[model samples]
Every structure is written in C-alpha cells, then in structure tokens.
Target: MSAPDQLLVVIDAVARRSDGESVRIAKDVLCAGAAVKLCLPDTPAEFAKALARRGSRRPVVIGDDRALVRAVGLLHRGRELSDGALSLVPVGPHGSVDLAGALGVPLGAVAAARAVLDGAARRLDLLVDDSDGVVVRGLRVPAGPSGLAVIEPGSVWDTCRSLVRTLVRPAPSVPTIRTHRLRVEADGRVLSDLDDPVEGVTVLSRGGVAEVVVRPRAAEPVRVEASAVTISGASFRYRADALVTGPVWTRTWTVRPAAWSLTLPAA
Candidate 1:
C-alpha cells in the first residue's frame, strides 16, 4: 500500500524528557512531509484517548520501545492494528529502543520520520495470549539463569535483537544448574511434563506458529513449532518483549499470522 498522507504523531512524554532534540527532529521531518496532528500524552489513559480519536490518520509513535509497545497493545486490543498501520521514531537512551531497531525501524529520528511518510506497511505476525496480551518481539523465562531455563534463542534471532542482547549479557553468579517445575505443551503435544523440571522455555513468533524451545537441566533443549503453546507451573513470570509480566499459573499463546501491520522502510 502507498504511504499515508494524514498522520497522527504521538510524542510520548518520556521521549520529550529524554531526547527533546530527536523528538523535534522527528516532528520537523514528519510535519514537512505530510499533514500532521501532534499529541503529547502524559499518561497511559491520555495516550489511549489520543489514539482512539486518531480517526483516519495513521498513528506514528515517537518514544522508546515501551511507548511503541504500549501503542501496539492499545491498537491490537482496540482491533485497529490491522485497519491502520502504525509507525515509530526511536527516540530515547541506548537499549531503550532496541525493539524498534530489532523490528527493522531506523533508529535515527529523521530517518524514522521520513519512513513514516515514505515507507510501506508490512504485515507481521504476533503472539496473542488468552489474557489479550501481545508479544511483538519475543519472550523468555523472567527468573534469570538459575531459576529459569536457558536455551539457544535460535529462530527468534530472525525477528529481534533482544535475544542477541540476552546472549551477550554478562554471566550470572549462579553456578549450579537449576530447574523450574512447569508443564509445557505445543499444539496439544506434550514437549515437557511437570515430572521433567525445566531450566528455561523460549517462545518466538514465526509465520503461523510459535518457535518453542524447552530446556531441562543437564539435557538437550527440545525444539518444536506450533500454532499454540501452553505452560502451567507455580505462578511464574515471563518477559514478553520488554515487559516482565505475570505470576500467571497457566498461560497460553496463539500465533495470529500477519495479524498486524507496521509502516517500515521499503526494501
């Protein structure tokens, strides 16, 4: 599809405080290129309200990855992600916008803004859980190396750099191998049972299935591809994208193929 002419520019308050110059640069580039309506939202409610009233204009978020994730979650829940493509400008401290860069958006304010006006909408797959939570990047066990499982972030590498960060992060102090009691199912097929304590579980969205890796301590990681994955344990938390979520006992995530579209620079 062609680029959008009308744009609803949402400059997150954090972005305004962190990097005013980048935000200004994004505004200059976007306003010069299209008809722009800017919204500087200070709170989550305000942000959602602005997006709700965006009307026919495309929403372009200017902030860090958290802002971008918030925008996506709001759009997805509102069932408007597919109707109107979202754009983003990465403006924040280092590591704050890695998800944006991992998603193939330019990190530079000027470049990202120009892409909003000149780029095309690319449909992407996302993981949607039963609780209506969305995972655009990927997720891992939130408890770290000792408590959670650690497996090679394999195929998830194709879609995000967050996994790369995970790989390069400094080693943890934990020396002994540990395990978490969790039962894992992939497409209704049992990959690991509760009897088999897990060291880690990694789930990443790819195509219409989720690339899943289940690791049991001192054993090789079991990999599978499935349309859905379910994990039930002693109320464990997981990192979805940049957010640490749950204490959820049992959680299920299903892949929605090409469910969302983002305005990205054309290849």
Candidate 2:
C-alpha cells in the first residue's frame, strides 16, 4: 500500500504517567497534520483489541521496551508485520527503553515522536523461534550454572544450623567458572559439539543470515553466519530481546530477512 496517511497511536498504560509528557509529545507531533486515533490500553487484552481494530492506520507504540515487544508480538502473530511499518516513542524511567535506543529509535519522547512523523521506513531483520516467538534485538544463551538459588529451612534453629554449615565448609582449591555442554548448529552444520563445554552463545539476525557466536570454555570463540541456528542441551534458559524464555531442551531460530519495517530519523 501507499505510505500511511493516518496513524494508530497505542499508548501503553505505563506511559500514561501523571506528568503526561510522553503522551502529549506523541499526540502533538503525530496529530499535527494527519488523521490520528489514540488509544490508551490499561491491560494486555485491551492492547490486543486496540491493535486488532487498527484498520489501515500505521501503528505507533508509545511506551517502554516491553511495550514495544508486546506490540510487535501481536502484529507478528496476526501476520501483518511485513506490510505495515511500525513507529516507536519510548516513554518511561531512564534506561527503561534501551531496546528502542538499540534499534535506532530516538530516546527522547519528543524526538522519537517527531521521527515517527518525519522519519523514513527502514526494513529490519527479525529472529523467529520454533515457538513462533519473535526477537527484535538479539538472543543470548548464558553458560555456567543457572543463577537461581533457593534456600529452605524448617525453623529458626534449622536456618541457623544451615548457615553455620555453610560458614564452615572448605573453599575450593581452584576457582573455575562452570560451563554447560551444548550442541549448537548453524544452517544444519555443527558449530559446537556437545562434548565441548561452552561459556555462552549469542545469535543475531543480520542481513539475510544469523550471526552465531559460540564462546567455549577454553578455546577461541567460534563465529558463523547462517540462515538458521539450533541449540540443544539440558534444559537451558535464554534471554530473547527484553524477555527470558526457556528451560527448554532444544530451540531453533531462523532469520526473517527484512521481515518488518520501522520508522527512524532520515540519514
């Protein structure tokens, strides 16, 4: 379709602060000379409904990083991402909208909203996992032991006894970082074997390939470019964009080249 003349501005509840700076900036900039439909969604269900009702208007999200992810997930699930260009006006406490900043969206509410009105559409790559989840920034699979620690004691005496035991235990002779055994594949070729312990794995969608980097415990890092990547091992958790998902045994992510477009400042 032709460039969008009307816009659907979906402002997340978190962005609707008492100060209202973000909302005001977005409305003023976007509604200056265009037809705009503004929506304030208090809940996820309301957010979905607002998007579903956005007829031909291009969507502009005004909120933090999570809010951006939510809107993108909805559009991707509905199969409308590729054709519609998205805009973002990140609003929240400082550092809360890092993803938007990383994606080239201006961080200032006024500047971001202005870009939404005056910027150009740039098609960007996306990472789509087997579960149909989308990753906008990147994905990281951490190595070493999971960071979660749990403590349980029957009573105050039990807690004291456990603490005394921990205080008396001998320390290790040599401190070493724990590593995980993972099988990593890129475009069906093995990049890391399960026999090798890995420190971590990072995957990013760049151009038409997935840039895969595998950090081994003792060897030089291995980097490869492929159209897809698959990782299998004991249940492992991964951080995708701004969210953490898994404890999954295996997961595959493929590169969707130029899968969606975003509005950003003109070069």
Candidate 3:
C-alpha cells in the first residue's frame, strides 16, 4: 500500500526526552518509503500556527501530554477541533498518564507513534473551559492540605522537623475528593442548584452525560441535556486535568458534540 503524500507533524522539545523514542519510531515507520515533513517545535504558539497553516493534511504531535493538549486546545478554539484530526505521542512524565489514558495512547512511545501512522480518527467528547482550553476527559481539583496534616510552621525546631518530614515523608494529602456548589444549566434550563459541594460535574451531551461518574459521596447527577452548561462556585477552584484556571465566583461552560476528532486504532 502507498503511504499518503501529505503529512504535517510537530514535536515539542520540552516533551522531547519522553517522546524522543516515539518520534524516532514514527519517523522510522512513517517515513519509510513515504514523503513526510517532521518539525520539532519549541513553543506552543509555533505549533498552533503550524497546525493552522497545515496544508490539506492531518496534524500529528510528538511531545508530552501538554503538547497534545495544547494542540487540541488550538484546534478547539479555532473551531477546527471538530473538523481537524489529531495524533499523539506521549513524551513527558507529568500528565503523561492522564493524556495517554484519556486518548487511549499506548504506554510505549513507539507503539503510540505507530498508532498515529495506522490509526483511524473518530468523533469524541472534549471539555472546554472559560478560556476554551480543551481537556480530553475531566479535571481534578482539591483543597490544599490542612496544616495539622503537616509539621508546625512557627518554631525553628518545628520548621526543621517539618522540613525533614517534608523531605522524607510524602507531602500532606491534597484532598483527592471535593464537591462544588454548582448551578448546572443545559441548553437554557437549570438542571441543578446544589448548595453542597458535590463530586465533579460533567456537562456532556445526552450520550456523553450518560457516562457521568461521581465519586464516593456521589450527588445527584444533574442531567445537562443542552448544548451548553454553566458552572460556578465561590469556595473551591476548578482544575481542568492538570491545569488550574478558575476560582471565579462563576464560569460558563458548553458541550459541543463531536467537537474534536481523534485518531484511534481501528476496531
């Protein structure tokens, strides 16, 4: 079979160490008897421009999780995510699991890279924040660890002890769980106005909403049957995956169906 003639590929340098092997593998498998241009991008802006200006071809990114997210974010905001196709090679340690897990990228860099060359794209769900930042699955937000959970702060001796403990022992646990006072509105109707902080709220389409997951203290899953949703809170900040954006009193969010297309291993 003949390989496609036009392909646009970008790699992030920061994510290079983790992605280096995969990048090489992609080049090896993809470039073999094929015409291709692989670019190593230093900044997200450059990647965005390259992705936008790409000529009649799908875009592939080789970098850590952030690189993949950034690429998606750009396409989403440019109104290109729904129409554009994306391929990912996990490179960085941080956020790598989240990225790979969400996108179904293989753990091995080479395997992930190979998926790009051979994978097929499918319409999928994506979350958009106030800034239109894109998150594949969801976010994790927790309140700071309580002071008693750690050594005392004032006394020099306590400080020394705390420092040692901090070095040797794990840091205080940031609450893995939280609930937010959310006012969820789908389409235009209010679905919830919970006063208690409930588990994370997911605003997706009907089919997407059916996939909603609530944690230990599960609250009533608010059905957001609309094309858009709005979330607000005064106590806790929101974490979109690894990116923390809002402590706002309120923020609006929307779910656009098939807003992004991701390349996946054919079934």
Model 3 lDDT per residue over 61-167, tens place: 77766677777787777877665578776666554456555567775666766677777887777766577666665554332332112223466786778789879
Best by lDDT: 1
- How well is each residue in 1-267 modelled by candidate 2, as lDDT tens digits? 244768899988888873387678778988885688999889999999999999888998888877888888888999989767889998866656878888999988778888988899999999998999998868889622322222334567877887898799976688867788899999899988889989889998877788999999899999999988999998888877767777799999989999989999988
Off by over 4 Å in 3: 1-4, 140-206, 210-227
Tell me the tens digit of each residue's lDDT in model 1 across 36-126: 9999999999999999999888898999888988988999999888896889999987678888898999999888988888899998899
| Reference-based TM-score of each model | 0.86, 0.85, 0.72
- Pull out the clashing pairs in model 1: 148-199, 149-199, 149-200
- Assess candidate 1 and give its lDDT: 0.86
Candidates arranged by TM-score, highest first: 1, 2, 3
The candidate scoring highest on TM-score is 1
Candidate 3 overall Cα lDDT vs. reference? 0.62
- Structure candidate 3, residue pairs in collision: 64-92, 139-241, 179-197, 179-198, 180-197, 180-198, 187-226
- Model 2 has an lDDT value of 0.84
Q: Name model 1 segments beyond 4 Å from true.
A: 1-3, 143-174
Per-residue lDDT for 93 in model 3?
59
Q: List per-candidate RMSD values in Å.
A: 8.2, 4.9, 6.1
